[model samples]
Target: MRVTPPFAPVTDHDLAVLAEQLGRPARGVIGIAARCVCGNPTVVATAPRLADGSPFPTFYYLTHPAATAAMSRLEATHVMAELADELAADPELQAGHLRAHHAYLADRARYGDVPEIAGISAGGMPTRVKCLHALAGHALAGGPGVNPIGDAALARGDWSPQRCACARPGPMLDAAGVAE
Candidate 1:
């Protein structure tokens, strides 16, 4: 799955389920061990929050670097799907809107993968094979284009805008209510 925001959270329940999935005891504590199957020793963490300053009754965020890195692309796809399933069942989530996230969810369904967490969703584009032309085009150009300024810059900064020869403040807030 494409690395999107909210890299799944690390709740107690998720660890429990993950342990069970790995054939470990359902009640034993499961911390990030050595290298992830993907060969990286990074584990990811997310924090699902509530209105109060304290964390919600749900989960925490932590990552085992090696483990997450070790995950194959296919394995990650399956894991993302499992996360979507759990998110689908969440009372806090708006289930109806989730249908639009099929690109991501379908991958999970296809691979029959389950997430360590029991209550989170994933969002990503579909992983269909690209046409040779598309690949060639991408190669001729660079890879996917990125917004030079990330979401953080857009949310809280007065970044310099791109323009023609003359430097000027570009327009803000498009008709569609997005940074154009």
Candidate 2:
């Protein structure tokens, strides 16, 4: 597997883009974990604890609206249950998930340790497939092969990371609640 370098520092322009995309100010963001083909942030690496001291165990958070919507659709189809069954039957998948759990912990440790969330990874990792968003986020951050379940989910989704789906010349959403 290929190794990704530590996250780079967040920039003002990145913050502006993130704020525009999220429709709110980004909080506890340590760095951009992954970017879309259009150069927009798809995932962000968040601090273990938020500014208000809430323990946030999801170190990698999915941010792109298109990507988030895709994951939601996958979850709605009961894909998580199917993936959970696969995890239970496949020893190789189980081992990969365990490694992913460890990697996630190591990445979060760089920010700070929160006793409340120690040894816990997001999306029911290392055992079950609870949240596709978190799994996709981890896959995007770590790249392919790092999160096999995530990779499979992404492959099954309608969206493609290689393409830019953002509404051109403006924001993804408009005032009329339309997708641009």
Flag regions of model 2 displaced more than 4 Å: 1-5, 168-180
| Pairs that collide, model 2 | none
Tens digit of per-residue lDDT, candidate 2, span 1-180: 334437767778668878877889999999988877656678999989999999999999998888899999999999888989999999999999888877888888878999999999988987888999999999999988888888888998998888887653233423332333
Score every model by TM-score: 0.17, 0.89
Candidate 1: what lDDT? 0.26
RMSD (Cα, Å) of candidate 2?
6.2
Q: Lowest summed lDDT over 10 consecutive residues: which window, candidate 2?
A: 169-178
Q: State the number of backbone clashes in model 1.
A: 20
Estimate the overall C-alpha local distance difference test score of candidate 2.
0.83
Q: Which ranges in model 1 have alpha carbons more than 4 Å from their true place?
A: 1-65, 71-77, 92-180
